[model samples]
Target: MATYNKRGYKPKTQKEKEEVVETDSATAEVFSSLDEGANKTEEWVSENQNIILIVVGVLVAIALGSWAYQVFRVEPRAEEALVESAQANEYYLQAVNATGEQQDSLYNMALEDSNGKYGLIKIAENYSGTPSGNIANYQAGMAYLNLGGANYQNAIDYLTAYDGDGSILEAYAAGGIGDALVQVDQKADAVSYYLKAADIQSNEFTTPKYLLKAAQAALDTGDNSTAVSSLERIEEEYPDAPEASTAKVLLAQAQIAD
Candidate 1:
């Protein structure tokens, strides 16, 4: 028997033919498994179509509702709060520059005006989540503080409610609370808040000022250690500050007391 050979063509052995048959069977099984899985998935989806649609609808509704709330409710309220608090802010600015009876009158107007406009107090209470409303809390607190006397507690309340989390105003609010606490004779609490104010933001103006206040408050509370430490920080870190000379004297006094 004679075999005719073709160019670049090899005949498969018995084992090779068996391997090819096995490979084809494996590929068919894989495709069959995939088809079965797809069919099961299709059946499952058909059975749960209502539940799936409900979940998707709920998610869409939640997203739309949140967007609507921000656009409609929150934005409008913020604008309204800004407008309402403008007159109060003007009064507060005037009070800051004025003296004696006029100052008191202007501060009172900032808190509550009889001119049919919402004052700082009302704006803070009504538009709580808005930026302007948050600012109104700080303004109202300062107004009460400037008014002095029994209004110190009201200052404390409003300042405590203020949310100036990440700004320099946070330090200012803390210092204002410390001031109010000092006026109310809560020396230890005042010391705590003064230190907090100094720690919140480390700037040339506020840092040394609050550190000096902290040192003074600590001295008043018989916390000679804190007084010395705070005074020393100001003397070392803020030598060029306006409070530096005062801090030096306080440091000397604190060391002598210690």
Candidate 2:
């Protein structure tokens, strides 16, 4: 007969004891797998310590090299460029303010200094990556344009080299190139550049002026549709501009042609 234990449950037989041992074995096997994974992770970390150190060392060297370059090289060059640019700007101002032959003389001086240390062309060539260098490009273009006739291609080249954004100078540079193209009898290209200038900064001052110029250029090229489009933009978006009246007249002519 089987013996009854507490709660009226019968005592375990030999088969029941074997079942209990099997369940305990399964639980132990799960824990053993977990322990094996942890041990493998620790072994991998210990084996790759030298490789990890080398990677960290390389990263530190790169950061320090960048810091050193900025402190020792870039800052000094920028300061030198600033000093030279101030002198060039003085010549530029004199040339712009003076009249006739005096203006031509000063513009020539600004392009090529006797000492060769300070001038628009010199600064632009010497410090090509600096802000002053970029401004020099714009200045050189203006000086050449002001000189007139002989330097029109030079004006276009330097104006095209200007890469600054969202500034009055940038808009002026594009417009200057457009003006040069007109002088060269490139009416279609002139229209494209004028539109580019108008859209680059899109302000009340420069935008309306260039848009009007674009309309005129397009009309010259027999592009009535483009003329109408640019004129419409000026009338709608910049009604207060001085060119708005001219734009209205051009728009009327363009519509008739279209």
Candidate 3:
């Protein structure tokens, strides 16, 4: 129950206490003098409570107005975006359902969903700035790759431009580049991207697969020494990975080849 002064950690002396009492008495006298000019808290509050209510109401209105405005602009745009994206997804699915050369029709449909709305390519081009557009690039890249595994160059191009926040998706893109390179006989390049994909560390399933692919690329390029090293890494680092079987087999093969 001890109060300290500003200068030191001690209570006020009697003189300071007396000074505080005098200050309170003087302040009381000043408040009394102002009583006749205004009804004080009671009158001021009564007179201005409606004004206060109106001010608060205006503030609430502003907050709600801002929220409504943002929703009006953002929601409709996002909805339109979803519509276009869904159409693209539908086209992709259609392509999946189709077989033989008829799949081109499905690809075109995806690009020109009966509504003449933005196709996947255009969605990728226009909304290239948005998350949806980035996904469009991913889908389009995959479509191209699937349609022409020989078009690995183009697949690598689009996959390179892809910007996904997901580590797994990014890893997939990297692996796609490796696959495309391998298709073109760029085994060394394939190994690089495959190694990068395997290093993504996003999921259990994809990492081992990529690591195996990297090791294989090394082997195919007559780098059995490096291939052996990579296989050993997968065996030791990802023993539980699905690629473990392949890694062991590759390790044995590399040892034999070496």
Count clashing residue pairs per candidate: 0, 0, 0
lDDT by residue (tens digit), candidate 2, 1-258: 223323555447877556656756988999999999999988998999899899999999999999998898888888899987887788889999999999999998888865656789988888887888888999999999889887989999998888867787889999999998998899899998899899888899999999999999999999999999999999999999999999999899999998
Worst 10 residues of 3 by lDDT: 1-10
**Candidate 1 lDDT over residue span 1-258, tens digit each:** 112133443436776556656766998999999999999999999999999999999999999999999999999988988888889889999998999999999999999955889888898899899998899899999899989988999999999899988578889999999999999889899998999999888899999999999999999889999999999999889999999999998899999998
Which window of ten consecutive residues has the lowest lDDT sum in model 2?
1-10
* Highest-scoring model, lDDT: 1
Which residue segments of model 3 deviate by more than 4 Å? Answer: 1-79, 96-105, 112-114
TM-score of each: 0.85, 0.81, 0.65
Q: TM-score of model 3 relative to the true fold? A: 0.65
Q: Please identify which of the two predictions, 1 or 3, would achieve the higher lDDT against the true structure.
A: 1
Question: Which pairs of residues collide in candidate 1?
Answer: none
RMSD of 2: 6.8
lDDT of 2: 0.88
Candidates in order: C-alpha RMSD to true structure: 5.2, 6.8, 8.9
